[model samples]
Target: MSDEPERQIKALTGALMEVYETLRLICLHLPVPIQLPRGPEYDLNTLVPAVSRLIEIIGDQPMREDEQSLVWGSALNWTAAAKLYSRYLLTGGDFVSRLELELLIQTAGEGLIIYLDGPDSTTQE
Candidate 1:
């Protein structure tokens, strides 16, 4: 792995974590007046920007041969999740859309773990 790929992966991972945390907060703060650690301002403004950075990273980098499948699949999954999340917000948090968004984010997170930890680690688990 070259330094550039490593850099991109690290950046991607950070962006993914941000988006994931934002979504988690959105879900948690929906039904209750709970005080989240990050306060009560986690909304589309925050999510969309983080997601935009994530998409940019995914789009700008070419998938390396070593982890091509995982990267490609993750890219698709993240993009879908972002769109679904937008729909989820627009529809006033539909349960089905939320569920679907969760699934996509979960799958994308797993793919990211595989990419970061090395593909062989998947079999070891």
Candidate 2:
């Protein structure tokens, strides 16, 4: 949301149009054959949209227990996990919120995508 171009982040779910575009720019500038921390696995095609959807869904609350678990395992009771805003509440909040944030970050890292060399270089997602 910040107006400063250097610090704006639109990587989370349902990222603003600007943010998504920024992500593409970042990927384009990365060293050819983007390498992730976990592995070299990368896909430019579905990476952006997948990460966006995951963040949007996880950040939105009142989600079913199953949904939360799918996002990330629930270490504690989902019923008492509190609201989504609670992620910053209670002095950094509980495990669930923290877990969601961690998972989101991990997904961002997993977003290593290929840079298209030409029109025929990239595949449809």
Clashing pairs in 2: 13-56
Give lDDT tens digits, candidate 1, residues 1-125: 55854554354445545645543443243223222235245454555555444444433444455455555466567667766666655565555665677677778777767766765865655
Please write out the lDDT profile of model 2 over residues 2-45, one tens digit for every residue: 35322222232223222334344443343332221121343323
lDDT, each prediction: 0.55, 0.34
Question: Each candidate: RMSD to true structure?
Answer: 15.9, 15.8
The C-alpha stretches of model 2 lying farther than 4 A from their native spots are: 1-86, 89-91, 113-125
Measured with C-alpha atoms, the lDDT of residue 87 in candidate 2 is 36
Q: Native-vs-model 1 lDDT?
A: 0.55
Best by TM-score: 1
Distance from true location, Cα of 79 in model 2, Å: 24
Residue 60 local lDDT, model 1? 42
Sliding window of 10 residues with minimal summed lDDT for model 2: 73-82
